[model samples]
Target: MKAEKWVFGFIFVFFLVVTPIYWFMSGEIAGTFVLGFSALLGGMIATYLGLTARSFDPRPEDRDAEVVEAAGPVGFFAPQSMWPFWCAITVALIFLGPALHQAWITLVGVGFGIWALSGWVLQFYRGDYKH
Candidate 1:
């Protein structure tokens, strides 16, 4: 995490320095926007790492340990289902709607997408997998 923080911090600083230099050299608004946005992204990553570091101790990966111990079982993982396939079909419809200029199809796609996502999220809350 500390290494991640430093890497992002370096990127942030690099962008900060390059943005002005790029603007002065090219005088292009688009270049400045790109550089500024990149800097903002770097800052966001660094900030997230710093906040996360505060919440938990360093992990074996973070410490560069020669031999890391197992962290133990993670949690229950949901079994595979068909929701993703449905979601993909919905996405295809949504993209196709815009290409064919049909608003109704796009609306239907969005509705179905939401339903599929909801079903996937609650799949384990009932039936055989219910805890």
Candidate 2:
């Protein structure tokens, strides 16, 4: 936690110092704003980490711990599924349709988005995972 705080703090300061120099050099508004926003995000992360508890138990990297010490059951992770990918495609189509001036594609995307969302949500309920 300490290391993370310092790292993000460095990032925040680095970006803060560079944003103005970049803006002065390039004379661009968008990139300058982006850098400023990046600095803001980094500062927020560093501040949050600083305010949180250091931790009751030290992390593995913080101590002289072996790989076997850390090796254990993590938790349940989802098995392979393509619904998320399909859902992303549907979102792209939804936005692309308006950008391209194609209403039909947007409608199709909406229909598919519903299917994707429901399929992802109910996948285990109807499948082998059901009990």
Which candidate number would show the highest TM-score if scored against the true structure?
2
lDDT of 1 by residue, 1-131 (tens): 99899999999999999999999999999989999999999999999999999899787778766553636777878787888898889999899899999999999999999998898888888888887
Q: Candidate 2's C-alpha lDDT?
A: 0.90
Candidate 2: residue pairs that collide: none
Off by over 4 Å in 1: 64-70
Off by over 4 Å in 2: 53-56
Which digits, one per residue and each the tens of the lDDT, describe model 2 over residues 1-131? 67898899999999999999999899999999999999999999999987773645766865788988888899767788889999999999999899999999999999999999999988888776663
The CA lDDT of each predicted structure is 0.90, 0.90
> What is the alpha-carbon lDDT of model 1 when measured against the actual structure?
0.90
Clashes of 2: 0
